[model samples]
Target: MTSLLLVEDDAVIRTSVSLALERYGYHVTTADDGLSGLEAAQTGGHDLLLLDVMLPSLDGISLCRKIRETSQVPILMMSARGDGLDVVAGLEGGADDYVVKPVDLPVLVARIRSLLRRTTIAQPQPETGQVGATLAFGELSVDTGSLEVRRAGQRLELSPTELRLLLEFAAHPGIVLERATLLRTVWDYGWDGDSRVVDLCVQRLRKKVGAERIETVRGFGYRLNTT
Candidate 1:
């Protein structure tokens, strides 16, 4: 059973979502406010967190940052608004994914499962037929066998999604990786996947990998300029 911590302020939403999640075979633990959620998160046994963006004492974004300071536990943020800023803020605050309110249980469950899968996957090993055993682009070095990345002699703290995106770029340096291809490869998204996720993740990756490493292809998608 997958242990989950749900931090939601709304009474109806908390109860309803908890029951729905439990029916889907998850072991759900609920917290009604940010303080308690933070405390529960610190206690640290849950496999994932479903955090509401609005709460008392501490908002979801702040709580997410605080938790990130100590844990890399995958987080899925929930908000009533679909505002671009809210989504980007949640992702920037260290959330792995976000879903707007009035969330359809099925879709929410699918997202949860995907995030869990990403977290649980073992670090990849380099295979003979793989893209590359090791790759170096400028000062950046990536060891595919160990799933390690080093730049300028310093290691970067990247989420699994971020690491995968970087690896995809390294595999095909200078190739314009279409958003649709990235969605399928990095996010495992089907035709219905949102391209915005790729854009947001690319923005985040640029912060770590340096903005010059990835080039926006204007009307197309993105290309990794190894030069």
Candidate 2:
């Protein structure tokens, strides 16, 4: 059974979401405050974390950052406000995805499933049929079998989402990948999905892979620079 750590301060939301997730066959451990949530997250037993943006003692963004410092456990953030700044802050703070509150249980479950799937197939196989195949883009190297990425020979600490996004770009170097394509291929989202996830993920990937390696093609999409 998949286990989850849910951190939310609202008693009503805490109870309802926990029960709903339980019905979906997840083992949930709940924490009502940020400090407790942080403590539980640090213990490292859960497969994923579900966090509410507002909490006592520490905000969800801070907790997300703290968790990211040592772990790459999939994180999904829930916020009452869908404001751009709030969404950006959560993503930049290390969350893999976010959902607006008045939470739709079905949509939330789909997001959870998507995130979980990424973890299972985090290191996708290369097309060469070679074990330990490594693909190079300039100074950046990705060992698909080993699930490792090194830039200029230095290993980069990337979240699973970042790693998968980088691999997608690496596979089709110099070709423009539309956000819609990326949404389906990388994130498993359909047409109605938010494009901001792709943009924010690209921003994070660029910071680690070097900004010059990826080019934004205005009004089109983005491409990985092979040179």
Question: Pick by lDDT: which candidate is best?
Answer: 2
Candidate 2 C-alpha lDDT tens digits along 1-227: 99999999999999999999999999999999999999999999899999988889999999999999999999999988557777788888989998899899988999999989888878555567678769888998988788899999999999888888888898898999999999888887855677888899899899999999999999989999988
Question: Could you tell me which 10 consecutive residues in candidate 1 have the lowest summed lDDT?
Answer: 119-128
So what's the TM-score on candidate 2?
Answer: 0.95
The TM-score values for the models, in the order shown, are: 0.89, 0.95
Q: Model 2: clashing residue pairs?
A: none
- Cα lDDT for residue 77, model 1? 91
Residue 35 lDDT in candidate 2 = 96
lDDT of 1 by residue, 85-157 (tens): 7777888888878888888898799889888877755266546675636688887888877777888878977
Q: In model 1, what are the clashing residue pairs, if there are any?
A: none
Candidate 1's error at 197, in angstroms?
Answer: 1.9
Global local distance difference test of model 2 = 0.90
Model 2 steric clash total: 0
